[model samples]
Target: MANNTTASAASASTALKARIYKAPEKAEISGRSIFLAGSIEMGAAEDWQTVMTNRIAHLPITILNPRRPDWNNSWKQSASDPQFREQVEWELDQQERCDVIAMYFDPNTKAPISLLELGLFAQTGRMVVCCPDGFYRKGNVELVCERAKVPLVQNLDQLIDKVIEKLTEEKA
Candidate 1:
């Protein structure tokens, strides 16, 4: 009976909504949530957010990915654009509410926004950062994470593993 209940729980968690983005109204308020904060300037063809989500598909946590495929980084338009406003607001809310925030910095992009977000939550103890040595501002990121006592991984795999370990510990 215990084994059956465990299997059923795992099956149900797998079936629960795994990917969430720009759907604040449709979000599942239950269960633990991990806000995927990472490099988005890799290009239109490259989406690290989705890649991370796929890696952790087995986990039963909600993924808050703000990477909109159609996003256009028009700074001037964002101020008055309703869509952009909604997206940014949603991200902020999710960031605050998420149990864990996994951040990755791809060496290929400058990722200034990711850096700013990292600064915002580095000390919250809810962050797991991956900033490889090749990143332009890796030293700064490393220093911040070190000071904040946030776990810093050298690669995406470690980042994912850290998130999984942390969330699993919570369940225990």
Candidate 2:
């Protein structure tokens, strides 16, 4: 027989209103949480995090978004830069704390950091990656995901589905 517990968990998740926490502020993840780990090179990438937020807003979860609204493009990206260091540390900390890392590789942007994140978290089995066709390192992403047994999707829609799947599975 199918598990009644799984059905009840999925039903409960649907009633959840999502709470989002942007960077620099430490989030209190009381329950399920996901870190939006993706391409955020200001101009190079689109605000895909918003899309993820809108889609998953119904799920009872905390979204750890690193796209700071007050981001200053002129800040020096160096170890000596306090703001830069704070942002980096916040992202790292949130990713480590979250249950899931929803990562994306935008095709138009060369997301070197996203690739680095894939290497960092692929083996953790807490990642659901979306590397669409034309993304510069799709092949590399596929190989790592395949080996790590991570769920990899072809596009944003599928990525959302996979993330929801992971969240529901986590509930069980």
Candidate 3:
């Protein structure tokens, strides 16, 4: 009976520790919510997303990724589809609920949809940050970012630092 009690207590203690040390479901991004808008087809976007996720994990803000599965599945279909419009609207709604927008624009391909999303975010007067491919410039994306007043960042390190600075300034 004593051994059984000891085993139960050990299991309970282990479970408690597991719960205590569990990582949060969503990373902190300061008090502000940021929408991650990027070209989902490019490999660089995935790398940037991973870096951004790690950087955001330590902040207090919420990061919203519309490219995520739960946001919509219309991206899998043709952009001309009527359902795509609905999805775009829904994503715009999500963007409205956010405080800022961060986008990854690789110069190799013109990400038309990302530019559209940037336009919407800009129309709302939200802050926009663009991470462009380091190798190339002078793309149409530069024009959009310029018009939107989005700061272009060269790398993930720069982006992380800038985001932190922006969040701190906003709090001040």
Candidate 4:
């Protein structure tokens, strides 16, 4: 029993020393960013944001436009001042800094800004993932995705899983 205890203690000490001396591994998703392109006016945006946020919370990546203040009250101020422009620049910077982008398309109404972002990402040859709702798939979403060369996913759970998988593959 005494010999066994001494061996365990030695093993623990070795592990502690290794941990102290070893350099930390780089994060799997470090420096990665994602732009969430979706309809801000529709209720779908809030629902999708909640789902995406819960799914990607563990990742070492950032998601842009996950939440915004009440548009009805803030739109006037956002348009009049430079605040909206600053936010756009910030999102664009994050996009440039990221390795992959995940976008959501809701078919009830077209989000012109989202489509523009998709085009930009495509032009830059960045990895783009599209999450389109059932309604969106029946609309012009396919054309947009085709133009952007982005793979369309059906739901948020799948989107998160795919992102994690891609990050793992990139690391490997």
| lDDT, ranked from best to worst | 2, 1, 3, 4
Candidates in order, TM-scores: namely 0.81, 0.87, 0.62, 0.63
lDDT of each: 0.73, 0.83, 0.54, 0.51
Question: Lowest-scoring 10 consecutive residues by lDDT in candidate 1?
Answer: 1-10
Residue 94 of model 1 has an lDDT of: 86
Q: Which stretches of candidate 2 lie over 4 Å from their true place?
A: 1-16, 170-172
The positional error of residue 89 in candidate 1, measured at the CA in angstroms, is 0.9
What is the C-alpha RMSD, rounded to one decimal, of candidate 3?
10.5
Question: Which RMSD values do the candidates have, in order?
Answer: 6.3, 7.3, 10.5, 12.4
| lDDT: the better of candidates 1 and 2 | 2
For model 2, how does the per-residue alpha-carbon lDDT over 17-70 read when each residue is reduced to its tens digit?
676788887687856889999899888887888888777767777888898879
Name model 3 segments beyond 4 Å from true. Answer: 1-30, 42-45, 69-87, 123-125, 131-138
Q: lDDT at 64 for candidate 1?
A: 74
In the range 1-172, model 1's lDDT, one tens digit per residue, is: 0011212333444553454543344456446778888787735224656666766656666777776546666644464878777777877788888889999898888888788899899888899999887898999998999899999999888988898887667443
Q: Candidate 1: TM-score? A: 0.81
Q: After the best TM-score superposition of candidate 1, give how far the Cα of residue 146 lies from its true spot, in angstroms.
A: 0.6
Clashing pairs in 4: none
